[model samples]
Target: MMMKNVSLLLFLIFATSLSFAQTDTLKVKTDTGNVKKDRKKVEFGPGKTHYAYAYFNFMFATPPEEGTDADIFYGKSHSISYGVRYRLKLAKFFAVGAGVNYTYYAWHFKQNDNKKIPTSIIYDKEKLKINALEADVFFRFNFGKNKKSPVGNYIDIGGYGDRNFSTKRQFTNYINDGNTTGYSDYTGINTGLNYMNDINYGAEFRAGYGSMLLFAKYRLSDMFTPEFKNEISSTELPRLMIGFEIGFHK
Candidate 1:
């Protein structure tokens, strides 16, 4: 009976040890899995922090003409603009951005039929240019739930108050006189006002790893100059512009 009791006691001790060992193994495995899950979460987060970026834009208006040959008369129309943007996080899905942009416009007009023109023609005998400059402060709205976008897309809307400060406006006029000559010394005048302020509204779509941006703007002011001639009248037209911006931002 004593031997039987001893054997029974030993058996109970062994079973208890086995049970404790199994519980310890399970606890260790659970802790290891939790640690691995935590590491993975730390390695890959939703997005990145907000950043300040310096931006530049070269914009061109759509050619007013349809025919390919007509494009030659319109000349090279382009604008160079540069600015800096500050992004302030207002919420998880929204941010406020303000920036300053300085823009320059280059308008060129070239002569097509030189041989059919007169030397005395008071029109553009050579290439002429108009330079327009503007300083603007803008507010931008960003679209996306996350700041760091894996899908790589954003939309921005902004407005700028701009001033055109230059002394000359470029001009080119075809000689209306009914004459034909191979050469003419007359060309268009570069005439500009002292200071003209205008307001512009624009929107931009950005994507492609920060290399592509499509933008459009409309100036709500009538770009006009007072005519010195008594018979001349004031000009009125809404300046419409649209272009693509291709560059990088860091």
Candidate 2:
């Protein structure tokens, strides 16, 4: 009986020790000082929960829409657009962001009509307008070991969709024969031809000064709309945008 009691007590002690020695799978709550010293591992917050930033940027445009045979006489030029981006980081270096952009330009056409000339056709534009809306989703890769500034120098690459919300095509005609009569036609080009989806890639440099922050990125992508091809010219595969990006996040 004594031996059996001793055996039972030993078994209980063994079981308790094993339970205490088991490795914990749950993350133990930690303060700043309790954080691991490794800098390679990405850390979201010492105790905080979220990260966000606001950015303002400008993009240079390139032609992605090519003109048909009727569009040869139509001339188009490069334009610039500006917008604001709101970013939310869901993980260490992954973020989802959105932006709104607007751009417009007018094209001028010139042609001569003469009875002496073999071709009596002319093409000209009185006014044209192009407007767009863009949204982006990107993943940011961070560099350096600064917690407050987790993003020292990083690359922001993602994909975006651009939609043309409004487009206007206008033309003016003058009658050279018979009675003195002239007319102008204003067409609302509501064709669904104002949408673009492309992959975006860019790099950013970040720095902080006192209370002000400085940041910049060089972004480039390909934007094309076939329905509005007559309104634009096709020259290249990708459009280039080089401008300063300024933003702050906490």
Candidate 3:
């Protein structure tokens, strides 16, 4: 009886030790840092991506209607853009960036009068210009790291707000009167910005190589909420822009 009792006690001790030694495979937690750090801290100096840049943009507007081409955003997108921004890299794959940007967009159009010159045609080629000052804020995602470049290859999503403070339309009529010989130029007329809305807010997306990107934007506000009468309807539509920009950016 004494030997059996001793044997039973030994067995219980062995079983308890084995239970404590066994590890649970399902529960695991890793400590990422030796100390706590603020994720919002700003970084600067060498190898940083804070920069001022200039890029030529080929930007175009989306047509308002599917079948009709007469839209506020019609024609070619010849634009000039410049900005300064600071990039805060929080991790290998994520960053937050904000900047101020200035952009100028110009478009060319022609209105023809068939009745003005039946034998030959007369048309007014008008140039429209809009100047905007904007602020851009975005989050950037880097797919991987590249030590060769200051700015990584990234995808950016952001919001932008701009004041289209100035607008003008200038046109010169060209008369191709085969009756009168060649062509004649008329005095140019300049129109004001009163027809356009003063403010615009939009969403933007960009993807590209380091320092160069393809970009697009959709404006949430209407281009014109008429303050005047026109030949057509008083309401103007919201707009979209698509462009490419090359940046000396971080």
Best by TM-score: 3
**Model 2 misplaced regions, further than 4 Å:** 1-49, 62-128, 145-151, 169-238, 248-250
* lDDT tens digits, residue span 23-125, model 1: 9999999999999998766543223335556667766655443222212233256667877666555555555556666777654444453221111233353
* lDDT by residue (tens digit), candidate 3, 118-198: 111334556667888988899988887666667768899999899887787666777777765688877565555665677
Clashes by residue pair, model 3: 59-77
lDDT of 3: 0.64
- TM-score winner between candidates 2 and 3: 3
The TM-score obtained by model 3 is 0.66
| Residue-level lDDT for 35 in candidate 2 | 63
- Candidate 2 lDDT tens digits, 1-250: 9999999999999998877666332224333335664332434432122334454543333333222222212234333455555555665545555555553433333345421111124534333355666565555554445544534445566555555566554445553544445454433332333343323344434343311334343344434444333354343232333334545444
Among the numbered candidates, top lDDT falls to 3
The root-mean-square deviation over C-alpha atoms between each candidate and the true structure, in angstroms, is 12.4, 10.5, 13.8
Query: What TM-scores do the predictions have?
Result: 0.52, 0.40, 0.66
lDDT of each: 0.50, 0.43, 0.64
